[model samples]
Target: MTPPGPCPRPLSRALIVAEARRIADEEGLGSLTVRRVARRLGTGQASLYRHITDRGQLLSLLAGDVALRLPLCADRGDPRERLRDHWLAAHDHLARHLWAARVIADGEHAVGTAAAFADGALGALAEAGLDPDDAARAHRVLWNLLLGHLLNAHPVGRTGTPRRHGDGSRSDFSWALSRVLDGVLAGQPAGGRWRLGR
Candidate 1:
């Protein structure tokens, strides 16, 4: 008989993350516990600690991993359109991985993975004359809008995915984004300072 293949390699961080992500995707982010992941991997729960510090770290890692797949803003374009496109793409990305928005909402994990996208958005706004403070505030508002839209999409039997309404959810986001951007960019002078009525 052929000699048995070399013993499988010991558990690794990559393997652990993969299994944990699988758990999160198949079940839900709440189900991604060390014990559950270890049980699925045929390893003791304690073994996972060697690969991850805790569940919080696991959630952060998952969020960052997902964020890396999101689209980045175009280097050259109309600032308003760039912002609109970036947020729209982000909304679509989160809709596909609905669990990711939950991880982001739980903790600010998407920040690290989204560094490029963030910089792009900031740069585009700066080009459009938005001061740093205003840009940051706008960023927060857009981020909230994106997350809320994804989370509020009624699930088909609460499945871990957003259900599309009439026309399409994407179109809805685009429409909202345009109006929000108009408000954000309105009343701007050469210096880009804008104010909204309370």
Candidate 2:
């Protein structure tokens, strides 16, 4: 008789993503792989391909899963305060996942949740007086700032304070965010680009 194939129990993509996410949380995304996930699920790597083409696709799916946690902006509020809350929510959420910052930094993998958040944020910035193009640029700058802070503050496969100079405390983050917002407010003229002192 031929050797038995992988078990026939039905599997869902969501189940695979969940396992991948758990692995990421426990050992960082670098440790996440089709083989690892399959081992965790008591299945073969070939079985996983039915749900995900490869590790890259799985990572993109993971990115989207993480993005779901991003808080949406409210319909009404001072644009400055609203934007502040939006980014803070993002920072807090991404900070919790040790692997999230680096994964998100891979811009090509941007998915639905990330795109939705960006669209909303860009819309808020535009409403706050930035022209369309400037709003988009400001959004990019703000996002990079948050990603850099989180990546620096929480390196992969490590814990505790980030192994770098300077204060990485919540207060420091708030202060930095405030400064970025201030720059945006200062450069309020439509179509104008914001820049710090030369």
Candidate 3:
């Protein structure tokens, strides 16, 4: 006899993305096949294909979805504080979703979602008196810095709780972030001439 149809309501594309993201989080991105996602969603591979064109498209959609979840320029007084908070939040999010970081590292831009993050960060740097070029370059530098630190600090295949390195109970994040900002600020022109030191 033929098998019964899938329960009642059909799964939405959002549900598929969520399930795929969960699988990536649990089993790493390598295991995120259409068949694997369909198995997780209790549906057939054809049903998944209806929403996602292929594995690449599905991963891009999932990355974009997760990118949207990142915090965006929330107020906390002081541009520096805001910037630090923003970077730390991004750091935390990427650390939790390491595969998302890998996708970004591989040069996958999620268009609208990722651009919002870049715009917000660069705007904050501009507000802090960085020139347009400096602001843009600073944004790129900070992103790379945070991603590199997190990836190295929390390597894959290691078990147990993650640890943050610092000296005498101080947060390395705070120290490193402050130093970066200070360096940027110091690079600003003084009396219409670029000055290296105060």
Across 1-198, the per-residue lDDT of candidate 2 in tens digits comes to: 444455456777999998899999889877898998888777889889988999999999998999987778765767787788888877777767758778878676876776778887887797677878878889989988888777664456446756552245445667888899889777474333334461
Candidate 2 deviation (Cα RMSD)? 7.0
Misplaced by over 4 Å in model 3 are 1-9, 153-171, 187-198
Model 3: residue 173 alpha-carbon error in angstroms = 3.8
Candidate order, lDDT descending = 2, 1, 3
For candidate 3, report its TM-score.
0.78
Per-residue lDDT value at 195 in model 1:
49
Would you list the C-alpha lDDT of every candidate in the order shown?
A: 0.76, 0.78, 0.74
Candidate that scores best on lDDT? 2
Report each candidate's C-alpha RMSD, comma-separated, in the order given.
Answer: 6.4, 7.0, 6.0
lDDT of 3: 0.74
Residues 1-198 of candidate 3: C-alpha lDDT, one tens digit per residue? 454345355788888888888999888899999988887666798888888889988888888897888778754456676788898888777767778877877776554687778888887776676878988999988888876665564435435665553111125555777799779767554322234463
lDDT of 1 by residue, 168-187 (tens): 66776788888988898886
Candidate 2 accuracy as TM-score? 0.78
